[model samples]
Target chain A: MAELNRLWEKRRTDNFQMQLRYWNLIGKNSGLMFVLYAMIIIGGFYYKRWLDGLPEHFPGLLLISVVLSALSVRAPVRTFIQKADQVFLLPVEPELGGYFRSSRIYSFLVQSFVILVAWIVCMPLFFQMAGRNPVAYFLVLAAAFIVKGWNIDCRWQEQSIDDLIPLKILRGAISFLFLYSVTARLFIAVPAACLLIMLLSGAFLFHRQAARGLLKWDRVLDMENKQAMKFLRFANLFTDVPQLKHRIRARKLISSWFPVRSFDREHVYDQIFVKTFLRADDYFGIFARLTIIGMLVSYFIGNGFYTVFIVAATVYLTGLQLLALWKHPLPQALAGMYPVSFGLKRRSFVRLLFALLVIQTVALSAAGAAGMKSPAGFFAFLAAGLVAGGLFSLGYTARRIAKENR
Target chain B: MDPVLSVEHLTGGYSRQRPVLHDVTFDMNPGELVGLVGLNGAGKSTTIKHILGLLDPFEGEIRVAGRTIRQDRLGYRQKLAYVPELPELYEQMTLEEHLQLTAMAYHIDRTTFKERSGRLLKLFRMEKKRHWFPSHFSKGMRQKVMIMCAFLVRPDLYIVDEPFVGLDPIGIQSLLDLMEEMKKQGAAILMSTHILSTAEQYCDKFIILHDGQIAVQGTLEMIKQKFGDSRASLHDIYLAVARGETKWLN
Candidate 1:
């Protein structure tokens, strides 16, 4: 049991460390961080002002209750059971109840933050509208904690039974009604709590009955693997996660865009890189998403230095993400055996980067220019984008490649 | 005629302070197949890496077709194809795409590439899987892709490492036949493997490596003469050398 606890601790630490490393990478990008912070502060101020000026007839309490209860009902347990657990820990299942108890507690603690934040955010609106006493608000918080713990336990019980979709829906609907009564300050709070307790007791009985049946180890492992991959995928957005196995799709239509006609050695690498960019799910998805985001940002900001800032930032990010593509061929032995000079590979990569950045720059600058009625503003933004693209591809990317090769 | 690959006193490894291969020396001439036999960690891969110009030799030099990797890097690389022990492929690339990429890298013209790839695909019974990505390939199918790519180049030399693992019996026979055909066409092959029987049957000569150095290298007849045993099989001679039971005349 202690060994299992230690293993769980180590796995959690490693996951936490991976997230921290990528977060630090994101933090290092000062331009993106500045934009993000600026947007958040501005948005928060507007939200507070709007809340203060709420109309008298607004059902703010009902809205808050519904959203909070919806959030509270989704209590996923993070078991942290790795694939090796099946082989190594199966024989010791009798002793794992304590380990699972710890896991449930950890899940409850982690999930409680959402309910807490919802309460805090909605508290200001609640007081302005309901004119409720501070004591009553604290009661709501305490009731929320109880409901959250019950939801976590119910979810854990639900996983043991296969073909329980209807049961899950019924539980969700019942929890929503109970939470709604408490948060809406209905006279049914006491009875709602009683009903919740009865429901939870029934769930416990169901779990006990199912516990005698075979454990669904495959389903549990699959769910756990998916949970871990979600975090890894998030971290991958900031920096490369080498352990993240990339998902590939044929995308036959999109791949047809990069027709292979090159027989020359240099052109062959260029073709391969382009085809890879178009066919690889992650790279193509990142490129398309960033390009669309840059265009949208430019459109929203209307014409100004902000548009240029967004365009430049998006280009940089796209280029950075595409660096992972170069690593694709690194593991392939035939790539190393290619008779072409190393410079040729670098040159082809630079060309591809330049082409992609230039396309992004043109589309974004054109969008910005459309909003700016002045031809001078349009030409200026266009020239700036071209220059930034050139500097990024020729100078920044070249230096990075040089550093890597060295 | 010059030997296709010449490694003279080559010494190298991942780190400079402690080289894995010490003074490794050998040569493979055209129309010959030399088996590089060694145990795991015996520096077969390190030696291949050095010959492929992936690592710089700390001492001595390697020449392919009379041109050193440094003296003519592109030309030296152009004359040889390498098949690694473990297949490493672009996960996103289909079988056809991989062959096309190989053709492009080796500067084979489009017409020649199409003809050769089609013939190889038919020969390997993989015509139906030309559009299948490596993610869908079984181990033998992936190995066939590597072998097809290597043969498609039609280079003067082939560097193969553990070529028989995961191959079906038919695949193995096809590979052996292709290698023999290449040998008849005057191409040199340097293959490293642990399958001693296959090595003895197919290889024209053997370079037995032990502890980072070549313990003995010669034809079966020459090896028998050197070991003073007329009846010993190559596997027996190899085991004897590996166990340090041979007394060399040198």
Candidate 2:
């Protein structure tokens, strides 16, 4: 037991150190803090405005119930099992209760802190929607803690069972109903007895299926790897994370968006860049998200200056993120062995970046122009975006990639 | 006839101050199969890297098809194909797309690419799973993809590092048959491996590297004659040479 405790603590310490290092790097270099601060300020201002203009039927109870239940049911246990642990700890499987119990306690505290903060943020809206004091805030909070504990216990038990998606759906529905019955202080007085019955039955079914003897070590280790990978993926957007390997998804729904059909010598780099952007990982996700958010802010700002700023910022950020495409390991490994010339690779890559940046520029410029006060400002914004995007991809990005080999 | 590859006093590694390969000189003629056999850290992969132009020799010259890499960079690389020890692939690419990409990289025309890719896929028995991504592949399947891609190019020379690992018996036989076919077509092969019996059976000559140096190299008849034994197997020769090498170092 002491050996297991020591191992768990060591792993926890290592994980904390890794997180602290990346967080420090992210703070020092990425300038992400400034972006986050600006978004928060903007969000707060809009949130207050929306609250002031709130109508009678906002469905606040439904919103609170949905958000809380979703958060609770999606509880992830942070087991710090390495790949080697399966080999090293298999003989001692029956003795890992203390280790897992510690993991449960640690996860619960962290999640509770997160839930508490979310509740604090939503308090104003809760009061506003309730139309008065109604129920004590701590009473709702204590109920939240109990529900979180129940979820954490059941989720731990459920790890041993296969076909978890249907069970998860059932758990999500029960969680929502349970929170709903407990939090509706005035209008609907559903019996607390009914909610307790639902919780106990769900827990009982999950526990019985999980059968106590065998722990799915591979699944637990896989979960741990996934949690670590999520953090590493986020960190990679800021700096190069060599440990990060991008995953593949076919994205059949959006396969039509890839315009490359010819596999000629000229389209070698083009095919690689485009396929990776569309299918490999987060490059396309980040591009689409930024474009949508930029357009949304532009549409609402209605100020020519801010709209122009939004257009430039969106294009710039997308360009910066897309630069990581060149640094990917596939291109680097191919760079040496391929009979392709350095000049041809550079030209093809720059061409693709130009096309991508142009698409974003046009999309953003159109949205910005529509939000502008005058017709003349529309054309001006459009022209500016075109020139800026053109110079960026052709001149700046071209020079950067060409310098990479040197 | 001109040799397909010539390494003249090649000495280099990842760094200059402490080299991993020292004064390694060898020549590979057309329609030849040479095996590179060594223990770990014997600089087999580094030698392959230099030949592939991934690393430059610090103080010597390497010429492929009569031209140095610096003199004709693209031409020198165009005549060579490389299969790494462990496969490196684009995760999103299907097996067929990989062949297509290789064709583009090597400048094979579409008609020729389709013909060669069809034949190679049939050879490796991978035609059914042409649309499968690498994520779904086993180690043996991934190695087959690497082999198929290399053979599809039909370059003048092939550099294959440790090709026998993780391959099924059929995969191994297919690879050997492919090598034989390529040799018949006048393509030279430099294969690095530790599978001694297979190497002894297939390779026309052998280069035995020990601690970054070529300890012994020759055809089997020449090596056996040098050791004053008319019937010394490659295993006996390798063991004798390795022991002699250790004694000399001491």
Candidate 2 DockQ vs. native: 0.51
Per-residue CA lDDT of candidate 1, range A1-406, in tens?
7886887678678777877888888888788789999988997899899987878899886787687767777777788887888988899877877777777888889778888888888888878877867887776777667767877776776667776676667666666666667666788765466575647665565577467566677777886778778877887777767777557789898788786777888876787688778776478888888888888787778758887787778888888888777776544577778888778888898899889988888887777777665556566667777788788888988878877762
Complex DockQ per candidate: 0.55, 0.51
Per-model fnat list = 0.75, 0.57
Tens-digit per-residue lDDT, A104-199, candidate 2: 888889889988887777777888876556365566677677778777877787778876887777767766766776666633445275366557
Candidate 1 docking category? medium
Mind giving the per-residue lDDT tens digits that candidate 1 earns over B1-250? 8899999999888888999999998889999999999878888999988888889999999999988988988899899998988998888788998898889889899899889999899889999998999999988898999999999999999999999999999899999999999999999999999999999899999998888998889898898899888998888887887777857636
Model 2 scores a C-alpha lDDT of: 0.82
